[model samples]
Target: MEKRLLDYLQKILNARVYDVAIESRLDPATKLSQRLGNQIWLKREDTQPVHSFKLRGAYNKMVRLSPDELARGVVCASAGNHAQGVALSARRLGCQAVIVMPVTTPTLKSDAVRSLGGQVILHGDSYSDAYAHALELEKKHGYIFVHPFDDPDVIAGQGTVGMEILRQHQHPLHAVFVAIGGGGLISGVAAYIKAVRPEIKVIGVQMTDSRAMLNSVTAGELISLPDVGLFSDGTAVKKVGQETYRLTRELVDDFVTVDTDAVCAAIKDAFEDTRSILEPAGAMGIAGLKQYIAQHNLRGESLVAITCGANMNFDRLRFVAERAEAGEEREALLAVTIPEERGSFRRLCETIGPRNVTEFNYRISHERTAHVLVGISINNRGEVPEIRRSLATQGFSALDLVDDELAKEHLRYMVGGRSQLNANEQLYRFEFPERPGALMRFLSGMHPDWNISLFHYRNQGADYGRILVGIQVPPADLATFRTFIDSLDYRYVDETQNPVYHLFLC
Candidate 1:
């Protein structure tokens, strides 16, 4: 079956598929190769017109359709790469294409599909929901449903990537790391590679939060997940495809799952190495490669990592940029509670040495205590343990939230909550110097009865830093609160009428 598929792929490659330029000869960086102790090669699938290997499979599937089926058109469900591929391929084949996508999918992807001449139907809240809707449409309209990574023809189409890699390389390939979602790409590549070179290792990578293929392979049966973390939306599959899982179980040599942080770090690495911004799924192969090399201590072996796609949302880049530093162990975040006293804030700053402070967020909710969240740069991964130990010694209970999902996803965004809300709340925007003792001076003059309701501060490169402070005062104490603000000797704006603070903080 594998040989037959390979033969069919060879014919398809020669007859139907475009001779996409092979980019295999590009040499790996000396620094990276030396660090990994392997001859690393990147398969630049992102260099393709559709910015992914999905086009190969889509084109192959469309070309083989009968005249009647072509008249009926082709339909599939996808959020990103597959949508673009199917749209472009159907247009090239002179057939109508319909793409069904989740409503949560970004507009950038939907626009690309439409631009490629595919009729896009936005429905449902998740990929599974969109897929079910697409199946219904297929049954109603008699349109061919092109499975993303499940069908045998699709697998054969993706197998062409492996064939190209082998043909492009002069040296023997020891291992190839490929990202797995529904597992079609890995299944095809593994089948072809194992057939031609049984000794070559085929490793599959999936995000730890969406590890359907890894879970299925481990259990020796197909397993479904109730929900998948969608950081890498391209590979967020609740269940591996039936055909792809079968092929993977028989052909894949090893499997690994990477956390979202690791995938983000790999994205930064790929950008630095190749000057290309790969989507989270595209970077998974590289993340898996790093883990594999570390686990087996495999040095001086030739390894290839397939950069699968680059269809990333521009808005997501902000989140990626924020987490990339901590993901790479170049930054650390600490949540610490300290006494709400004059000199205590300064003492906390004294504990942090020359390491540049990336972020500082503090709230004076309690009369006697203040909670401050601080982000600091780290030299390397080894510094984390030492930093934790130092904070412990300083009588500060510190929570290391460098890789904590709750902290990264929710806590950071909604840190200030209703816990601090009280009657007569006044929000003030104050600008202060960036030097030490600034916070101490601000807190020293505060009235003992008045309480801080909310506090938010993020350092932007500015001459004077701005902070939002919410203070609660009794109705009778309005005059006293005004006097307190006047005594602080800082310009303040009353945000009591701001709708955002009233709705969220109140």
Candidate 2:
């Protein structure tokens, strides 16, 4: 190991955090192990007092502070997990703490931080926004800024988790899967593990849409994401820290990205194996582990995943449940067009055979053929193509809607609402910001000249708020409407000409 790397390894070895954090257990996922044909171990950091590994870094860094810095107190910004860590650390250290969080943060997380004796300030819409607000507070109040994952001390503190994992498990570790946000946890873990067990791989996991670190490492330079998905809010960092980026690129063996559905499925996997629920960010490692295992087709080797946090919002479970089956490729959603003539329904069922039907929705159309949405249970993703081919063989056209975000988020719910009364009504799909009053801001942004005929939205705990809107614009105002949309500055798609809209929602 290089001199600087060895120095960090020593810091991780000597970090003091037991005053608050505990040595989380290395529990084996026996059921998952049997299913995957490999030993899968979970580093139970969710069992931390704050229900996250963040406390380790928070307390470790705070304890090392000088008397003057301790007296000055601390402030930091986080989506949720690190806020709780800072809060709990401050409560223990007998110093005041101020946690700045995005207004889009989950209520459960914000409440937890408040209960831990930290003053919670609900600030901007994004972590970058909150960080900016936090910096101002730091300067104004003479508070020490507590970086969530940037500082060497924080990274070293998190490295203790690697130490515990190695000491607890004598079995050869093929890889240690970790979720990366600002890269502190993985950086610390990777540094220690590489110094001590160089042969073992340190893999980093990230949500596909929120993978700033992944993109940066791939580019071989730090990259800033203009926006990030919020399903895994704790790990939705726009940019990784400088030191963390350097360490991660050097120490991490590979990077893997999983989508929202995969994380949802991983959450279900954890619950099934250990009867414990993990948040989306916590489940990221498991999702990446499953993806990696399938990609390499490896078996009989031991692998470890950090089941890092469990501060899940109760309401989010419904969305997680809905997507888990699809994520695991146990379910496939299809849109089928069938003739309105007699025996069409029976023939469709016959074609579907005895496959478990999870969802079936049908609406009569004015056309000769009708569109119906159906979800079928399957053994794996490969079955989707087979089913599509089977439907084609039966003279029915089937469109696989499993990977279609627009279909899953909106079309599935609004397929029955076909309209023809409003002339020149334009259909649009929008990605609104997730912060409070976002809808109001969108509504307010529109000109009164363009009347909103219809609007539908459901929060999925994601960074971008998905909303579908229908507005009436006179043909004469088409150019004005185009200009208005451009001024809105939100990601949007004109769905006015979409066949699905024509079939059911025009």
Candidate 3:
């Protein structure tokens, strides 16, 4: 293992990527360091010319090709970053590059690649599809193929990040966190770090819903995920690379998975420290780092996290901002019901105390009870339970909304009165696949007797479609309704017992 890692480390030390890939700075995350009680160093790969660390691997691999192969051009498939890196490298090397990208790849990224002089071909829905299309093109045109992360040269090139980190910081390090997609970055970094600075841990980070590498590592074999989340679209790979996986199993020290809300909070944290907005995949390292520290109760350790890219879609920032507070436990959302009598509102506010109210929505459900959806600022995660206990002691029925997906995503936006006429309505939150005819399929799959009473949907710049649905089912058809739900393919959660539903639409 040492000999193999040393071989990769030597390749990394000699990787020819500096022609297009600059040495990104290891900047101090002052605010995060102070808050976490650790020295948090951010490897600013977001400052690369193409705004990603991918350039190092892409350029190194392409530059290694013979002049004859270069003249024939190069082809590759990528989610976004590697496409941009290849495009920029091609432009620098005076070679033609054909980049096949998934249709779901953001226009913000595709446009960046095109601006770098690469001929862009929009392919299937995901990177795997694009890779297949690239393979066909590679055969037809006899072009040199540039694999994004599966190739040895790419992994070795990415190892340059570890080399630079050790050079920048001489202090005893705790860990270096790298976000994994197909595992190229971590494979390379782990090899180099373990070979030279074996004391420092090499941690891999992944989005919880799309963790091909983490799942594969756990299973001790490569496994494909049926579907992957697209919120952090850059790392939404469904399969891990074989070579990358082998390297990871032997070299990586730990792996952590974080959710969308946590990644959003990490993006906000990055901005607070450096005034730079990173894409969801880029902020994953910091998110996982925060989670690891909390789980392990570690403090005063020196750590580094690679902020890998900044090609964030502008439209996605609104959604990130909405969930960031909840992820950081900076805000607590609640559904509180109060009697419709006079002075009830004032009494509710008094019960809430002087805490800053972040959001408030109120609507009368009936002549007796009114539901109020409110968001309150809190100092930490502990404050949530304290606030809930306080409300309980004051005879107010409060439902914590921090972990309620239905309430946070859709219910808070809609505050209409209960259906006085409809009978036996059941509420559900569904994650519809982001494809054509999804809504039609959902409608067709339902039984005619189950009428959809209430519905709300808004695209959160993610792969899946989220909708809050209320259906009227007669008491006799309860069994049939449950059977129909079990047959449907989409992921769903029953929200009928949710206090927010009772308050707003029961």
Top TM-score: which candidate number? 2
Per-prediction TM-score, please?
A: 0.78, 0.96, 0.92
1-506 per-residue lDDT for model 2 (tens digits): 69989999999989988988999999999989999999999999989988899988998889988889989999999999999999999988889999999987888999999999999999877788899999999999999999999999999999999999999987788999999999999999999999999999999999988999989988999999988877888898899999999999998999899999999999999999889889999999999999999999989999999999999988788789988998998989898988888898898999999999988888886668888899899999899888888889878999888887777888888777776676789989988667667677777877778888878999775556789889999899889888878787777889888766766676
What's model 2's lDDT at 460? 70
Clashing pairs in 2: 230-463
The residue ranges of model 1 lying beyond 4 angstroms of the native Cα positions read 1-15, 19-31, 34-37, 339-343, 365-369, 410-506
Q: What is candidate 1's lDDT per residue for 335-358, written digit by digit as tens?
A: 777777888888788888787988
Better of 2 and 3 by TM-score: 2
TM-score quality measure for candidate 1: 0.78
Q: Give all candidates' CA lDDT scores.
A: 0.77, 0.90, 0.89
Q: What's the lDDT for residue 99 in model 3? A: 97
> Model 1, residue 124: displacement in angstroms?
1.6
Model 2 regions lying over 4 Å from their true place:
433-436, 459-464, 475-479
Candidate 2 whole-model C-alpha lDDT, 0 to 1:
0.90
